[model samples]
Target chain A: MNTVFFLVFGLIVVVCAINVVVQRHPISSAISLIGVMGSLAIIYLQLGAEFMAAAQIIVYTGAVMVLFIFVIMLLNAGSEEGGKGPLTVRLLGVPLLLVFLGLLSYLIQRLFSDTGPVRFGDFKGGSPADVGRALFSTYLLPFEITSVLILIAILGAIVLARKELD
Target chain B: MPAAVPLSWYLVLSAVLFSLGVAGFFFRRNIITMFMSIELMLNAVNLSFVAFSFQLKQVSGNIFAFFVMVVAAAEAAVGLAIILTVFKNRATLNVDRIDSMKY
Candidate 1:
């Protein structure tokens, strides 16, 4: 069951991630990124990070992606101009990327050879209550700091995005 | 009984996603698409974090992933605003074209 869930959602994530890159228009890419995030949420559930899964949906797919789409729309972002760049990049880009991916997988597999298979229900500490407790207690400082970070981001965004007065 | 997925497989998937994100960042000319690629990379890392959290039987990985998500949110807000400013000044979203500071 766990394997099946992982394969299905994992496939969705990979395909959508590729779509996000391959699509020409920014809006199309944004929507594809949302697809990637949604499938990742399900994978999070399979991994027993239930709270993270919900937050992935609400914060990432819901709020962050909405902001992305709004920016694309407001800017009237058109499709990328047609020109695949120079010959070396066009010819070698994908093959080099594949090599890089293969190298990363090889390294990860060798490093994690001793770890056990991930079983569903094995980690029950990912519930919201558990995460909230950790956030408020052990991670209290970081949590408070993130609020300040967010406040600064809000102010920065407003200042940067507002109209330029004469 | 259900088949077991090795922990390395999850890491491998994360690697693949991260690589794709890198590919997008380098190959795509559009600024927004490039920014989205950065977001994709962040999500890929978050997956790895959660998987390690599950492996170690600790909720700390999930907490870390939560923090990553919060930071990604803040980043998106500020990043989009920056993109808007860039667009207003340059009137083009192509990353290659936006290079006015190229010496």
Candidate 2:
């Protein structure tokens, strides 16, 4: 049952992610990326990290994807010739891509092959509460720094997007 | 009974997703798609984090996942904004054509 669910969710995410790349228009690509993120949040829920799942949906799907779409719409961003480019230049990446594919498969095999028994049980008492405790207690510094980083990002984005100071 | 799936399944799923992201990152011409590929890679890492968290029977992995989400959010906001600003100045978002930053 879990395997089936995992496969389905993973398939959904992979498919949408590919669509995000293949879609010519930026707006549609953003939309497809939202679907990918949404499926990932669902996978998080299945892992029993409820708070993480919620945060994934709220932050990635709700906040970030919308921001991406908004920027696309505001700029009216589009590709010349609906995404056509010089075939020679584009195909120049083919050999590099083949190299990447080789490296990826090697890494995947090396990582997953030596694994022991797949532990498929739940944490005895871990819950969202435990997550909060860890966030504030052990990982507090990084947590605080991440907030500051986000603030800087927001300000920087606004500054970049703003047309004029006056 | 809720069937138990192995950790390798998640790990393998993540690897596949990550590879797809890599392909998109290199092959795609559009900056937006490239950003989406980055997001895909991040989610792939999150999958591995969750799987390892479950394997280790610890809550720390979830914590890391949260942090990754925060960073991803910030990245999306800043990256997309930069793409937009670049488009405004150059009139096209093709990364090849926009080489103003090249030294």
Candidate 3:
């Protein structure tokens, strides 16, 4: 059951992630990324990270993706113009990417061979209560700092997007 | 009972996604697509964090993932604004064409 769930959602994530990169129009890419996020949320649920799963949907799919779409619409961005980059990159990009992926997978599998399999329900420490406790205690300082960071981001965005003064 | 998935599978998936993100970042000509690729990379890392959290039976990894989400949110906000500013000034979103600073 767990394996099936993981396989299905994992496939969705991989497919949608590819779509995100392959789609020419920014809106299509944004929608594909939303699909990727939604499936990843399910994978997070399978991993027993319930809070993280919910947050993934609410924050990423809901907020971040919406923002991306809005920006695409606001900019009226069109499909990517067809310009095959430098000859070396155009010819070797896909092959090099495949090699990089193969190497990374090989390294990860070898290094973590003994880490054991993940069984759903084996770990219940991902509940909101547990996460909240840790956030307020051990991670309290970082938590506060992120709020300030968000404030700065908000100010910077507003200032950047605002109309230029005469 | 169903068979368990090895932890490495999740890690491998994360790696594949990250690599794809890198590919998109380098190959895509549109600035928004490139920015979305960066977000894809961040999401890939978050998956790895959650997987490790499950492996170690600790909430710290989840906490870390949470912080990553916070940072990603802030980054998207500022990044889109910058993209907007770039579009306003340059009137284009193609990364190849917006090379005023490239020497």
Q: Over the stretch A4-118, how does candidate 1's per-residue lDDT look in tens digits?
A: 8888899999999999999999999999999999999998888999999999999999999999999999998889998577789889999999999988888997899999888
Report the lDDT of model 1 for residue B77: 99
Q: What is the C-alpha lDDT of each candidate?
A: 0.93, 0.77, 0.93
lDDT (Cα, tens digit) per residue for candidate 2, span B23-56: 7786667777788789889988988887778667
Q: Which consecutive 10 residues in model 2 chain B have the weakest lDDT in total?
A: B1-10
Choose 1 or 2, whichever is better by DockQ: 1
By TM-score: ranked, best first: 3, 1, 2
Runs of candidate 1 with Cα error greater than 4 angstroms are none
lDDT of 3 by residue, A1-166 (tens): 7788889998999999999988998999999999999999999988889999999999999999999999999888989899878899989999999999999999998899998878889899999999999999999999999999999999999999999889
lDDT, candidate 1, residue A118?
Answer: 86
What's the TM-score of every candidate structure? 0.97, 0.86, 0.98
| lDDT tens digits by residue: candidate 2, A17-36 | 77876777778778888888
Q: What's the CA error at residue B85 for candidate 2, in Å?
A: 1.8
- Shift in Å, residue A26, candidate 3: 0.9
lDDT of 3: 0.93
Candidate 1, residue A24: the lDDT equals: 95
Return the top candidate by TM-score.
3
Sort candidate 2 into its docking category: medium
